[model samples]
Target: MLIFIILALIITILVIKKSKTKLQKTLNETVSNLNKTIREKDDIISELSKYQDIIDVQSKCDELLSNAQNEAELIKKRYETLLTFAQIEAEKIKEKSLSAKKQMDEQIKIRKVEYDNILSTALEQSKQIISDANIKAEEIAGDAYKALNNHKELEQKAKAMKNVIEGYGNKYIIPTHGILDELADDFGYAEAGIELKKSRQKSKFMVENGLAAKCDYVENNRKTTAINFVTDAFNGKVDTILSTVKSTNYGVLKQKITDSYILVNNLGEAFRNAVITPEYLQARLDELKWAVAAFELKEKEKEEQRLIKEQIREEERARRDYEKAIKEAAKEEEMLKKLMAKAQLQLQEANDQQKAEYESKLIDLQKKLQEAEEKNQRALSMAQQTKSGHVYIISNVGSFGEDVYKIGMTRRLDPLDRVKELGDASVPFTFDVHSMIFSDDAPKLETELHKIFNKNQVNKVNPKKEFFKVNIKDVKSQIEKMGIQSKWTMLAEAKEYRESLAIENEMKSSEEFAS
Candidate 1:
């Protein structure tokens, strides 16, 4: 940009210089030619004067020449001054051009530097932006790959599972001290439940497979394992496991077992005893595996006992706090606090009472268990009197018409005794007692059999009694409701009917006294 301006100024100076030179040359040529032409003309005028009135003519010619020379001189002086002014103006123009040219060059240099800086900055930013984009893209791709890998891992795990997905944590296939029944329920089907129970039994309280194999008691343990838990039991060191299931070396696990006593705490004792109970099928249980369950149960029981004591202390403190609150109530305006305290005391007392009731219920349950034990003992003793024969089913329970029958399981437990315990009297003897059709889970079998048999369908034993089934639990629930009536007093007519005219005599006596 500055170069173009400088070129324009130089061109203007050259044009002005050339025009001044041409004007000067033309003026000089014109002046010289005029002087020569005047000289010749002057000679001619002088000669003509000499011919006629020569003297007079020559004098006039000389005067005229003098006048012309004076005019020419004045013109020359004016031209010279004009020429000088022109030269001075040209010099001024040149000086202005040189100053403008210098300024233009400086601006050009500054603009070039700025443009280069801008270009360099833009290049640097572009490189940085590209680098950042590439890094971010790579990170995203890596994350996507990781996600895909995780998904594949999950898919593989799912494929590896033989049956039910153990979405619930599978620390152990079936832990020791844990009930097999609970695990079975989680698996969602009866057969699976049976397998879960079988797993629990195999583990006993849970031990390494090799350790379990060492014991004669667990020789027939049917559980197959992805990881063995019985190897520690063989070495007699189940508490500190530092070795694998297949290895015979008693390292970490052995150390742990030796250091950790099995039967020190109440929970430990409970679980140890549970592993040996016949109900859990201890005879067939892998004692080595049961150790794991025992450990867990012991921990849980310890926590439960600790919480129970804490709650008891809290309740006692609350009760004591309330008892003292009445004394503070005197000479006080805030009856509300006292009232609230009293209410709190009552609530605490009630809670204590509820806890007592629960404990009582536990006692009752214990008593019931004892009774059950006695009954079982009696039944065992009466095994001699027991006979495999037909039993009667002649009665039904409740008004919500359903097939609730009196099912007698052989002749071991008297039908009358069973009926009475069920809170009902047995019906009068009717028809013949039929032959035993089938026997499985008797309670469940009975309910299903009755559902199939339908109403007035006595002595009619169906072949598909085994296949046709009802939930015994549901039947038992219904039966339970029938045997007890919470609102017996609400039925006015039934109440009156049961008592007959006992109210009439009392009414008559009150009326007579009034008269």
Candidate 2:
């Protein structure tokens, strides 16, 4: 019985131990499954948090896009307003330009009308002059033949011729054997010599009688060639008249113009003995008519000169006035400098107000001194500008012959000394003074005179020659036209030249008789 009970107990114990082992194995498997479940739950929570973050970033991007659209709309509206303003301003500018253009066109038309009126008036005046010339020509033709027929009238004719030829008491006349062209000289002198041979007995008779001077004057003064004489005479007289008309003051210009009309009439009368042909006389008349345009040009030049002189005078006066102001400023500046220096020294002992006053005065004085110095420098620059010089009009008939004069300028105090030097050894005789004009800017005056006679210049190549084949009347006229005050002596008392000419004529007369 004990063995059976022990076996039963062992079996029971084995069964109990097996049940406990099974229970422990089951618990370990459950624990491992629980751990896997926990790990998967944690991964899911981390993925959900990542999705929430993406949602939040998308919301912010959408908000930013909306704000950018709003800003872009604002910028578009602003640009549209600016564009509208620009278009309006552009339209206004276009309208203004067109209006200005129209006004300019209107002014140009007005100027054109004024120019036409001036041209028409000038034409009428020219026609009147031509008519006067024709009437004078008729008078000369009528009086001339009758005068030639009567001996007493011939004496009057001779006196009239002398007055005309010699130019108001032998003033313009040079004691030369006429300023003849080479061809005219060769032909006319030869022809006149032959005629002179025929008139030797008559000349001898006149010499024996008291009519030698008259005969001698006629022979010396008369131009045998008609075309040359009329051309020269008309040119000379017209130039004079033109100069007078252009240069004379308005008060005297009308009288001078009327004198010009009388001059043409007188020219016809004076040259009637020389200019026998109608063709030559017509040419002279035509020349006087053509001279109208020339006169207009000269007047224009004179106006230009007047404007230039006015400008120069204005500049000079401005400079002088400025210089005076600068000197006064300098004087004031000196006074201020001394006052400022005293004030500066006093400032050390003075209070705040006085120190401030001293500094202000010092600054003002420095500014003034600077201005004065600048003005004084400008005055120095102006002082270096064209200084005064002497312009002289002189003639040497023995050297250069009739109607020729020298236009020259010098900076010398005694301009006559220069003239004397010129006449010393280079020329056979001394120079005759027509005038001496002093100018602040002599070069400008000299240049204008040269322009007047550029065509008639003796030495076109050499500016130093300063000689022109122009009459003294022309020179005087040009000078006077320029508003230059000059001491004028019309009498070209060529004493040496006349003596030399007399000696030459005496020798010629002796030779001609002997031959």
Candidate 3:
């Protein structure tokens, strides 16, 4: 039994040792698995912290965006309010300006009416005064001439007695009275008569030689001397003849001498009344019937020319309107072409209503373009067929300042007609024609002239508006270079315009005085 116990104990000892070795192996494997699991838990905790940081940053960004949106809305509202206020202020200012302009225009109209009334009154007064003076002067001259004729007839009879005494070949006899005087009557009746005759002859000569203007003063003095001499001789002769009537039968001569004395006194009065007159150079413009008729004809021609110019202006206006229409049509056509292309592209992706609207617009544009093309053709034909005429270079310093000239062409029978038309109401003064060149190719010549003055052209776009600001010398040089023969009217006879200005100034002065 003891031996069996020892063998069992040994077997138990072996079993115990094997069991301890197995337990050690299991403990090592469990420790390794625990370390790996702890490392994985640390990695997951780090990833979760990173996600929490991301969430915090997103919340701050959203808060900043919300604040910015609120600020932007505040700024937009302020800007709109400010814009509205500015517009209201602008409207108030515009209203005030318009009101002020209206008030000023009304004042100007009142002043103009007052000025017109003053001018009319002054003109009427001046005309009446001039007419009265002329009429009075003529009447005085007529009375003086009638008195002088009566004096002449009486003096002739008084001199007959002297002639009979001198018929006995006593040419040297000097007579102060009807009888001869040796010492006293050196400047006697015959000498006085000769002087009077010479004065009459001189007056006649002056009129014949176109020097009547000079004869007035000379004739006045001569008439005075003649009257004095005849009166003195008649008084002396009456005394001598009356005393010697019984001794020599010269009583009839005394009566004749008395009549001559009275007549001579009347002649002296007549001569004193006579006035020196100016030479009637030709006749007054109004009195010359033919001249008045010619002026009327010129005025009628001007009216005709003005009508022609109006027609031309109408045609030009029509042409410009047509050109504008054509340009608009072309623009519309191009826009339609683009729209049609866009519509076709959009039609592929567009809804039904949008496609139909685009199609309608395209069809309408096509119809409008066709109509525009037809109108353009008509306008182009009319413009092309417009008649070209003489090219005129003209100047009006009063209308356009010096060195500003109008270089234009006209298709009229008379180029002067065009010049007159330009010088009408449109311009304050008449334009003096510097040159009028009539040519079959007037348009070409005009174009050439415009090109020469391209740098100095006043209106650049329209070659038809051929106004140039250049020295006349340069224009003349260019004209010469073109080998065109033209006349230059250097003198500007703006008579009517100048007179009108003078009248205007006079009226202005009168207005000032009245005010």
Write candidate 1's Cα lDDT for 1-515 as tens digits: 88999999999999999999999999999999999999999999987876777777799999999999999999999999999999999999999999999999999999999999999999999999988976787688977755665685445444334212432233223322234334433333344434436665555543433323321232244322211323323223332232232322222233233222222211222222211122222322333333333333444456667866864654344344333333332223244344445555555667655656555544554555455445544444433332322233423222112333334443323344333343333432221221232232344545554564454343332322122123334434544454521111111122222343467777899999999
Q: Any idea what lDDT model 3 has?
A: 0.63
Report clash pairs, candidate 2. Answer: none
Q: Give the candidates in order of lDDT, highest first.
A: 2, 3, 1
Please report the TM-score between candidate 3 and the true structure. Answer: 0.25
**Each candidate's TM vs. the true structure?**
0.18, 0.26, 0.25
TM-score-best of 1 and 2: 2
Off by over 4 Å in 3: 1-388, 461-463, 508-515
Q: Candidate 3: deviation at residue 42, Å?
A: 99
Q: Is candidate 2 or candidate 3 better by TM-score?
A: 2
lDDT of 2 at 130: 82
TM-score of 1: 0.18
Which model scores highest in lDDT?
Answer: 2
lDDT of 2 by residue, 1-515 (tens): 99999999999999989988998899889999999999999999887987997899899999999999999999999999999999999999999999999999999999999999999999999999988876777688876645455666446455545555554432332211122222242343345445434444443444344332211124443533333444445445534654553333322332333333334434445444433233333333333323333443344456667867864764555456556765875676687678768877887888977888877877886787687777666555444555566689899988888888899876544568668878997679999988888877877888888888899999753445689898778778777787777789887888999999899999999999999
Better of 1 and 3 by lDDT: 3
RMSD of 1: 42.6
